[model samples]
Structure formats: structure tokens, C-alpha cells
Target: MIIMPQLSPIDVLKRSNAAWLIRDQWRNILEDAYELVFAGINPYTQDKKAPRSMNRQFDSTATASTVRLANRILNEMTPPFDNWADIKAGALLEMTMDKEQIAALDQQLSGVSKLVNILVNSPTAVSARSAAILDTLISGMGVILGIENPEDDVVPITDQAVSQSEVAIEVNARGEIGGIYRKRKIKVREIKDIWPDAVIPSDLLAKLNEKKDPEIEVLEVTYEGGPGSNVAWYYEVLMCAKGQDPHRMVERTYDVSPWTVFRWMVIPGMPYGPGPVLLGLADIRTANKVVEMILQQAAIAMAGMYLVRDDGVLNPDNIRIAAGGMIPVQYTGGNGGASMVPLGTNREFDLGQLILDQLRTAIKKHLYDGTLPPETGSPRSATEWIQRIKDLNQDLGVGIGMMMADVVQYVRRRVEVLIKRGMVPKISVDQLTTKVEINSPLARAQKLSKVQDVINWLQMANAAAPNAVATVANLEKIVAWISSMMGVPPELLYSEEEKKKIQQNIAAITAAQAQQANAPAPSQAS
Candidate 1:
């Protein structure tokens, strides 16, 4: 009676109860479920197991018919086809065939639809398909659940648009948010009145204003320049504050004057042997003896000049040079006659050599005659030695010419004044005589008239003294003057005391010799 035109399996299934059971008409609904089941089967065997049960409460004949129909549907449908059971069951229910078959088909369609729904909605099933489809669906939800692959063109959440009502934010170049300011700027009225004025107590301020003057006063002394002498040596002296007048301070200059008698010891000739013959002789031993004597005299003179007792007046004792000299000069004949010479006095080289020779002879005599100690003996103190040399020079006619004796006496008087003033010590006159003997430049020249040599010798001697005032150029003048005066080397002389001592010693020696000579002839009584 109701003959349904030959319906395609899928079309029949769609109109059946199975299609009503499915919630959504997925594009490949039944086809996808059938493919899943078919793919799950082993291709090596044609006999594949069914995913669902075939036996049901349909008519035995209908069941066979339904199975035959399923087989025919499978044969007719292509790769993408509906589930065979679903199609068969849907057909049976729609045709209202036997009640029992309808009931059974309805129950089968329900189970088949439930299975399709599970497979379609499951995450596991979704993942089983291509991932591109799932990603597209998730991206459409508007929330980025995870990081996109670097190669993808997906924009990040940060790039999304924001509204004006949202908080304004700033990202530093480092990609971090900038924070709030913590410091504020202020304005100043003036810079000049920044510091507060310092307050001073009345008592402290009064003390600062008080004046206290020092008692010491400085004195100035100006010497009138001499007519032909453009040069003058200047010096100073100190006085007690008591009974001192500030106006009289200028007069103190007269108290300090240049020393009149400038003296130095003569180390005559060179020492024995090949070294520089300072004293002129080739024998080093003899020369050394001479040098030692000269040094002794020089030392003594220095001591007397500074340390000897003198009157209260400053005198020559107050005068002192900066330091003793050890400087030398070489002689090369020139317009000036000689390159190297003493700084003061007019003595020539030949006279200097003669004086040195005489000094050497005198020193030798003392050494050989045993009148003085050997060179190695304890030398007389510098002061004693100089005094003695001066004494010897005066007595021996070696110092101060007859005409210059007054000048020498004037210098000695000044030295005496210094002694009386306690400015110099009370040294033995004998010692002073010895120092004068050796150090007197005039005496040196008197003993040797070789003006050039004398000049050289004096220059050398001045250079040897500490703080020598004479200049070599001036020494040349002094030498020239001495030469013009027709001075000759003086003979050795003695003082009365020394003469007495010499006479006594000679007498004793003579008496001994006479006794020896007058002794009875060796007894030859035969």
C-alpha cells in the first residue's frame, strides 16, 4: 500500500527517528561516525566487526530484510555514507512497519544518535581532526589562551585598542612603566644675603682693638764712599735694650768695622813625591810638615779672631767671614798677567814662591831641630797656633815692613780692644806672635820678593781660610805694590824672651861640648 520511492540511505536516515535524536546537523554527521568506525577496522581482513549490536526485537523476517537492506545501502553509498543501522532503523520507524520493529528501531536509533553526539562533541574527537580547524574556533572566542607561534600573523593582547576612560600609562624606552616624581623645585629670593653675620662679644672685640708695641728697634748704618775705593765691606752688631736710644742706633755701626789684620797660614810647597807641590818642594814628607805647620797657625788665628777675650767694644773679634775657603785657581798668563791668584793684596808669583820656600825652611828647622813636635804630634789648638805664628812673624822681621809697622800696630791695638771688651779671649801673646808670623801677608812678601809667586801664595792661603774677604784681582794689586816697594825676603828674628831661652840652651850645649873636648887625654901611662 505505501510504496516509498527508492530513498538513498543517508536521505532515509535524515527523515528517520535517528536524525531527530541528533541535536545538530553536523555537515558530515553520520558519514564522520561511519568513517571513524570503518577506519578503526583492519584493512588486511574483509571480515570487519560491527561497532554496534545487530540483533534486536524486530521480525525475524524483517530483521533479515533489514540486514539485507543495510548491505544494499552499504553497496549503494560512497565512502561518505550514513551509519547502516541508523539508516535501517530510521526507515523502519518512519514506515510504521510492525509495532515491535518500530519500537526496536527507535531504541537502536537513540543509541546510534547518542554515540554520534559523544564523538562529535568530545575534545578528544576534535583534537583527532586537523588542529587548524580547532585553533580557528578558539581564536574566534576573542581570548588568547596561549602564545602564538612566531611565524603566525596573530596580534598580541597588548596591541588591542583601549578607551579614553581607561588609565593613561607610559612605558619607558626599557619597556617598563614610568613612576611618579618624588622631588620638588623651590625658588630663592636672594644669593648675596645667604650667610648670617657673625656676632662678636664686646670684651673680645676690645682685646682685638688693643695695641702692644715691641721694645726692639732696628738700626741703619751708612758708610760714606771713599774717593778711589768703590768697594767697602759691611757688617752688623747687636746691643742690649737697656739705656739704648733709638736715635743712637745709627751710631752702633761705628762699633762694627772691617778687621784690619787679615791673616792666613801658608802650607808651603807640595808634599814629597809626584803630587801637586803646594808648598813648592818635590819632597812630599817635607811639604806635609810645612802644610801642617801652616794649618796649625791658621787655626789658631781663626780661634783668636773669634773666641779670644776682648774689651766691651765689638772690635775685630766680632768680625767673621761666611766660611773658610778651599777653592783653587790655575795661572795662565794673559792681559792680567796670571789667571789664578789670591783675592787681595799685591803680591806676584815669584815672591809667592819665595815666601812659600822660606815658610818651608822655617817649618823644617822646627821639625829637624826638635824645637817643635813632629807632624804626627798633638797639634796646637787653632787659636794657639795662629797666635804663636803671629808672634813669630813680628819677632822674625817677617811681618809688617818698617814703614807698615804703624799699620800693624794699629791692627794689634784693635785686637787688644776686642780682648779688653771680652769679645775675644785672653790668648798668649807668644801664640799670637806665631799666628802673625805665618799668616801676615806682608811678612810673607818680605821673606820672599817673587811678586807673582807671593801673589799666588797669598791667593791660595786666602782661599784656604774660612770666609776669606780678599779677591784674586785685588791680590794682584797688592803684589804689584810690594814689588814696587823693592821688598826682599826678611831674615829670621827673635823676641827678648825667645832670645834669652835660645842663649841659655846654647850655653848649656856649649858647656857640655867644652867639657867633652877638655876631658883628660885617654891615659896612656907606659
Candidate 2:
């Protein structure tokens, strides 16, 4: 291996601009998503204000529902401080490694998951990730990007959720992410600290001295490159200021991409996916409008709207109807010539109520609002509870699958950086092929039924014929199944190779006991 040269940063900037133009196709929808579901934090602007339509979402059902679902989604996908994913040894690795390497490999595999957790559980990671998950729900795409942070000894990983507005991605026909381009506004003073390669002008320093802290933009792009055998991800950074040519900052290449892109759904040939919020945006708007109308109706009934004759002295604009306010009216003719007549507040509320309720229910269900069953309802049996969790997970099956897939790639990408940084022991290519099994709360719930099923089967088998139990049940598989269901941390459990060693020990002990039992007592006979 000879390492190939990376593209110049200027080229990176040009390609990124082209991709961003494509992302603009999603600009309007992304704006709508942030308004309705993500609390209007527009990363596109430094002020981060929501768009004006934020007020239009008066019903709040979509916003509330989005938040509730995002939390649940996070807990299920990658709960903070919990072992949400497990790294399992692939079959090839297990069959190849002998007893001596078994314990070492197991220990190595265990540490990988624990260390990855520490990196992800960092304050910044969770804070940003929470937003990214919401972005996934609201805009259909969310991003977890690993950038240089100098303040840390561990993986200088950012936990800040990158706004959709800051990111543009190119996806291939096979649903693989081909490129990721992100732009950020940074204060001139801090640029030197973040990117060691950054150069600051004396003029910029003078501005910083004046406490100006003028903002400069940086465009970072990571794109797939290399011919078939030499395939790799390339990275670049460039200074991107309006009305100026992109100045190259730095460039590099990596075996794995630093970007972890999450999409709610994958539509073939589409560069991005749209989440449930976009699907229900119409309903959300409609519901909000209906509620606002209903409130207006109530206001009209309480503080009656009135019409006055076109009288010379009434001056309708001056009319003030407070608790005890006074209004002067001139009487000039019949009915005082300034008499105010009531404008009818009378209107039907039933139809609006119906539409609103229906929209709310649909929105809540779409967002997985986690509405609990009535506490007054009959208590559920253990079996019923297990089944319920299974049903819920099944309903979330597709989204969960997509999220977990992204997570697997994310973990592997993290491993690439971690190994180079010596944060974790280096795992070979075969080891990297290991499975990333999700073990989140929802996963545990879905697996609980399997555990129950195994237990019930074992109990029935032992009751029907105790002697046949050993043949009917694989003790190792049974225990492993139970452990998975219990959501045991990978660090605390034995790997497949280690379990094989344990089974061998058990078999040896059993064989010895049987041999002793069969052996005759020759000394006693003599």
C-alpha cells in the first residue's frame, strides 16, 4: 500500500457547492419541518429563530408529538449511559481463532463496545444526537459528524446536532451515502484553536482585538473516491466566504467516512428522505388553523363584535369595551343615530372539533407519541405485556432497521478513528465484520417474548421427559438467548468463542463423572 493523493480543497469546495444546490430542493420542506416539529431553531442563521410559520402551528399536536417520539426513538436507538448496542463475533472469526486467543479476543471485543459508549455518552454527543434524532423525524435526515475538538483527550467527537441546513448529502441508487458536505460559521478568534491548519490574517487579528469576532465560513466535505481496489473516503476543508474564491485549508483521506448520516426513510434515486412530519404537515397546518378559528369563535362570543350605523359621531375606532370603561356617543337622531348593533357570534363548532380531533389522533400515531393506556384499565398479564412490546417494535420495524443500520456504520467508523488514536485496541478486518446487535429498551421488550418462549418450551420438555431435555435444548443457546433478552452489556458477557470453551469444560466434567460411575471398584472386590 501506497496511499493515494487527496483532491485539493478548492475542488472539494466546488463539488460541495454543487451538492448544496441540490439540497436546496429540500430547503422549503426542511424549513417547514423545523417550524412544526423542531422548535424553529434554524441553524441557517446565527440567531436560530424559527420561521414565521412557527406561530401557525397553534395546535401544537405535531410539535409535542415530535418531541415525545424523538425521546423514545433516542432511547430505543442509542440511549445515553446504557448499553444500547452489542458487538458480536462473526462466525468466521470464531471458527478461526483457537482457545488461547479466545479470551483475548473476547476481552478486546468487550472493551470496544464500552469505549464506544464513553465516546457517545460524552455531553456534547448526546446533546447533539438528541437534536439529530429529531431532525430525522422532522426533516427525514439527521447527521452525526466527527470534527476536531481540541479540548478533549478522548475522541474529539462533537455531540452537537448538526442542523439539516448545515448539511447536504449525495446518496447513490443503492442507498449508500456518496458524499457529505457541511458548512459552519466560526468566529475568527476560535478558528485557530479548532483547525490547527487555519491561517488568520493580521487584519482579522486586529478585528478580534477590537472584540469584533467577525464570523468566517468553512466548508468541510467528505466524499467517496478512488478506483475499485483503492476505494476510500476523502476529506477536505476550505475557507468559504461570500464573493471570494474558496481557499484550500487542508485535505486527507480515510479508510472510513467520518460522517454518520441518518435518514428516516430511503426512497430510491432521491437524494434525501422525508420523515413522518412532512407526511402529516398538511394535517398539522389544518389542525392549527381549525384551532385558531375555534379560539376566534370563542373570543367573538365573549367580547361580542358589534356594528354601528355610519353615524357622524360614534367614531367606531374609539369604542373601548373594558370592565368599566367609558365611551362617548353623540345622539343626533332616532335610536341615537350612533346605536351599536350586535354582530352575531353564532357559528357551529362541531365540524371544526371533528376535524381537529381526527388530525390530532393521526399526528400522534404517526409520531409515536407514547400515549399510555388508561391506568384504570385491567392490569396486563406478563404475556400480554411482552406481546404489547413486540407489537410496538414491529410497528417501528422499518424505522428501527434503518436507524440500527446507520448506527452500525457509525460504530465502525468510530472504531477507525479510535484505533488510529489508540483509544481502543486495533481490530482486524474480520473482527470489524462482527455484528452490532441493538439492545435498547425496545429491543429488550421485543426479545422478552423469545425468552419467555424458550422458558416455556424448556419447562414443557422437562416435564414431559426429563431425560430428553439435554437433547431437546442446547444449554448454551438457551442461556445466550436469555442473556440477550435481559439486555446484558457486552463487556459483562462471554463471546461466542469463550462460550465454546466453557461448553468444552462442562462436557469434560460430565464425561469424567460418567466414566467414574461406570468404573468397577476392583479393590473392594479383591
Candidate 3:
């Protein structure tokens, strides 16, 4: 019994008109930018006669750099937690039912988290025909849609299930993404497949069924909400191929809850997805062509140095362009002069190299503007390496912070959806505030510094009082704190009872050894 407001014909047309107006404005620019990234085409130089070799070379660098940065984020950051709900609720705050409940729930949540991670990393997680959504995410803004990927109907249900996100869909925009509209096509069959029970007019369904090739279309549009709303409205509008007026098929007033759509932006605060490689693409393409031109000029200068006498034949083709080749140039009637003249100079080549370097620097500079660090120089020691990582953290801090929020939100929404879909069993989560901790090399180094401070304090305390460290009643607590700071798994740690048992066994063994040492003369007396 899901109830939704039915839009009148005029109202539907109005909404559809608004959505298209927004789309019509932004589609070209966004599409062009996206094509530049995914297709490796410099739209400015995408003419049919453009050199394929040059395009490939430029694309390789751009794609490689983008992928490298994306991989760095994936590898360095702490993996998203599946038990974020429990962690968020401060489940360990109490020593009674709270702790027990949280502990029990963690066991279940751990398995769920692992399964989710598997699906995220697996090929099935990405959209069909997409090599990776992350590639587009880093290079440009990319969208990932969570749609039901139904399998065979007769399979037994299990927790080890695939993710629902079918593809990393790309959205096209016009100008700046801010106030503009965004739209993508959804096939009629795709809609039916994902939402079989969705409400639709009976006549439309019958018409669709009767047509051999139904050309029904649904436009999923996201646009700025009405005046003063400060939010984007998402809508699915029925767009028949015939001249029928567009009508709302489904509508959401704000951010799609539980996130059926996840948007990843390379740059924050801007609706338009700006990318690193894209910014310097024009320069890179031009530089590539310039280098080719320079080489061609140099070849002409060297090969064109032929001994041509004034009395020789003037047919240039008859003269084989090779080493030790004789050329029959036009014959001069009077005094014949043979001299060597180079068409191009080595000085120009020197200038060309400088120009090439500058172009490369431009490309590197764009990539290094927070997304990645430029290869300035190599660190000499482990300490230097740590310092370098810290520098990178500082450089990328703001961008990572923005990206972290979106990423965490995406994962959180996916987890919730998984639970609702019964792929993960629902666990009782209290008032927990879970946070995504980045365990990147830089972040880890910072954590280690904090842990070292704790160690330094403990050492001073032990020096002040002998056995002070060992005498602490809550030494295990300190150890646990340090272990957590170091990102050690909670399951790897020993419980308080287990620690007590271990201490008791050690004490008993020590006492038995001492007793035996003291009683050595007893056997001799007997």
C-alpha cells in the first residue's frame, strides 16, 4: 500500500518540461567532457584525420595517472566498515547487556561486511560494459546506480549475494552542474525488470505488450528544486516516442534515500565533474603534435642534405633518399657549385625539447594540484618517506575529506539497502556513531606518531616508579587503546578473563620453579 500523489496531465507535462529544460541546457558540455575522458578524444582535435598514435599516447598518461590516484585512495584508506551502525552507537560504552549485545551483533556484522566488500571488489559490482566506475569517478564525475540484478528464480537464498548496483552510469551536463539539469535514459524493459510491481497505466502496459519493438523511454532527471528549496528533485518521466506529452512515472523530492543512485565527484562544491587529465588534455595533445612535427622537420633537414650540382637533373623523385645516395640535380650551363645546406637547424630542435618539457610539466602540474603529488625528488630515508606522506596528506586533506563523506555515504546506503533486501540479516544497532577512518599511509603515520607519544609517556612513568607499567591495574586497557590506534582487529585481542587466566598460569609456573631451586639441599640431607 505505497501511496503516491498522482499528477494531473497538465502537472505531469509541466514537470517533464522543467526537467528537459534543465537537461537541454547542460547536455552538450558534460557529454563532451565525458567523451574526452572515456574515449580519450580531445574534442578540439577529434577530427577524423587526427593521429591515432598521438591520441593513444595522451590517453595512456591521463588514464594511468587517474587510475593510480584512485588506487592510492583505495589502498591507503581504511576499508569501509559494515558494522558502522554498531560502531556508531557506542555499543561498547556499557559493561552490561550493551557490551554483550554489541559483541554478538559484531560477529554477524563482520560476516556481512566481508560479503559486501567481496561484492564491491568483484566484477559483478560494476555496471555492464563498464571497465570500472572508479576510473570515470577519478577522471571525471561518475554515477553508480543501484538496480536489482535479478538472477535465476529457483536459486536457494544465501547471505553470499551479489550487489544490486548494475553499472557506473555517466551523466551529461550543459554548463556548470550547479543550477543545471542532469538526465539519462532508462529503457522500458529495464524499468520493468527492476520494478516489476511499479504502478503504471494499464493501457500503456497493454500497448507496450502488443508492440513487437516497443520504443518506450523513461527519462531519469535530477534538477534543482523549486525556488528556495536548496535541493535537487529526482524524477522518472514517461517519454513515449510518439508526440505524446511527457508525464511523471516516478518522482522523489530530495536526495534519493537509501541511495538508489550514488554520485562521485572529482571536485566538490561544483555540480560539474572536473578531472585532472581533462584540464591539461589540450596542451598534451598540442605538445604531442608539436613533437611529431619537430621530428619530421629534423628528418627533412638531415635527409635533405644531398650533394646537388647546378649541372645535375632537377627530378627530386629520381634521387633515392638514402645514405651514400647520388642525386642528379638540374645542370647549370656555366660554373657548377656543390655545397651542403641544411633545411632545419639543431638550434630549433633544442627549442623544441624545451617546449616539450614545458608541455609535460603542464600535464604533471594539473595532476599534482591535490589529486596526486608530483615526482619532485626521491626521499632518502624512512623518516623522509613518512614526512613526504604527511605532506601529501596535508595537500590532499580537503579533497579527501569531501570525497570521504560521499564514499562513506554510498557504502552506508548500500549496507542499509542490503539489510532491507534480506541479503544481510538485520542487527540491533543502538545509538552508535560510526565513522570511516582512513588508514592511508599518511593517516597511518599520523596514528603511529600518536601511539609513540603514548609509549613515551609510559616509559617516563615506568622510570619514575619501578614496575609502574606492570603495576597498572588497567594495563590491558592501555594495550587495547594502542592496538586500536594501530588499526588491529578487535577479534585478535584477548578478553580480560583470558588475560587473567594467562597471568595466573605464568605466576604458578614461576612459583614452582622458585620452590624447586630453594629445596635443592633436601635430597642431600635425606
lDDT of 2: 0.72
* Candidate 1 lDDT, 29-56, residue by residue in tens: 2222222222232121223444333211
Judging by lDDT against the true structure, name the best candidate.
2
Error of 2 at 184 (Å): 2.9
Per-residue lDDT of candidate 2, residues 182-259 (tens digit): 888777667767678665456544644675657778887888874563648877777776676676666667777878
- Best of the candidates, TM-score: 2
Question: Which rank order by lDDT, best down to worst?
Answer: 2, 3, 1
Please provide TM-scores, in order, for all candidate models, with all chains considered together.
Answer: 0.15, 0.81, 0.63
Better of 1 and 3 by TM-score: 3
What does candidate 2 score on TM?
0.81
lDDT of 1: 0.29
The regions of model 2 sitting more than 4 angstroms off are 1-5, 38-46, 49-54, 98-104, 148-151, 154-156, 199-212, 227-231, 314-337, 370-385, 429-435, 446-449, 456-470, 484-526
lDDT (10s digit) by residue, model 3, range 156-239: 112121111112222235322222122334456676664554466777767676876555655444343433443434334344
